[model samples]
Target: MTKKTRYGVKFYSVCTTDDYGLNLQIYSGKSDEAEGLSKIQTLVHSLMEPFLDSGHNVFMDNFYNSVDLSGKLLKRKMHTTGTLRQNHKKNPTAITQAKLKKGQHLSKRSKNVYISNWKDKLEVLAVYH
Candidate 1:
């Protein structure tokens, strides 16, 4: 098995699986950790552009989750569904502090959630399964 890290000389690969097994088509060495996203974006754009351009939903983990990156993917007309970090900021429009009347009943979910580093608020969607 090959390990993937943004800092080392490792191979990043994308694979397709079927009844037989996994087929690896692309592999490239990564050089820098800071340039990881841009490098991956370039690779994905070059190799997976066809699939992505077809409007397939791309799922990513929190490590690759960010508003800027998400916005870029959305710009390409690709739908994004990923697990956002728990500390992710809430959307400002979703806050209801202005509608509160002194001591109104407040549900836990209605509280204003904010992240210091995040400029805009994010809409939180909960899915039970």
Candidate 2:
């Protein structure tokens, strides 16, 4: 049940949500046996198994978002959208490093996925669509 921060360090479980807000306990991040990305993969699978092949969409913030994770979820017939970290593996470098003036935005898409980046304040925001 750890929380996500702008720094992109994640240490937690995966929860489910709906229009009413968080609706279920998908996985508990109470295990010490697993570490690093493997742990995240495990948590995501467990959290998503019940809805597999149901064509559900999962939305999360940066800490739980990654290109690999999204691909895996897609294979299970679950779609994902979230804020992605600029340095995430497979993230396009041009979008991540682009220096956009205020109000400027950049976007790209491949198949069912689209990525958008915009300048906000002093930082760039990367979103998965």
Candidate 3:
């Protein structure tokens, strides 16, 4: 989702392989949400409820990607590919500590999860499993 400030409603949506809308949740700001999982992770899992265990691929942005979350999704037969925040928790030490040049990148795997950090004008992290 875009972080740019805009005057309008926002919605989190799940789509099919062909880009068909499958399910959607209207964003209502962070209030009175569930207690266990973080709101975004909860929202992602719930949106994906119907499609779990069917080998679906979920693509998301940095706001929705993290190491633990990707592993959990993998266990449910779902694959996730998304941009990761540089300061995200639970990142592999080798990949995170590597010094990559402008055209270089580092990749490491733990179980089924593979995390990559690439440097261009700025450093970028991508996670998938």
The clash numbers for all candidates, in the given order, read: 4, 0, 0
Between candidates 1 and 2, the one scoring higher on lDDT is 2
Name the regions of candidate 1 deviating beyond 4 angstroms. Answer: 1-37, 85-129
Q: Relative to the unseen true structure, what is the C-alpha lDDT of residue 101 in candidate 2, on a scale of 0 to 100?
A: 90
RMSD, candidate 1, Å? 10.7
RMSD of 3: 4.9
Query: Could you give me the TM-score of model 3 versus the true structure?
Result: 0.81
Residue by residue across 1-129, what tens digits does model 2's lDDT show? 988755434434445453453334433346543344466666667656677889988887887777667777777788888888888777777777888898888987755566778776865544554
Flag the better candidate by TM-score, 1 or 2: 2
Residue 116 of model 2 has an lDDT of 79
Model 3 segments beyond 4 Å from truth? 1-8, 29-36
lDDT scores for all predictions?
0.42, 0.68, 0.86
Candidate 1, residue 52: lDDT: 60
Worst 10 residues of 3 by lDDT: 31-40
Model 3, 34-125: lDDT tens digits are 55567777888888999899998999899988987899899999999999887767888788778889999889898889999999998889
| lDDT at residue 82 of model 3 (Cα atoms) | 92
Report the CA-based lDDT of candidate 2 relative to the real structure: 0.68
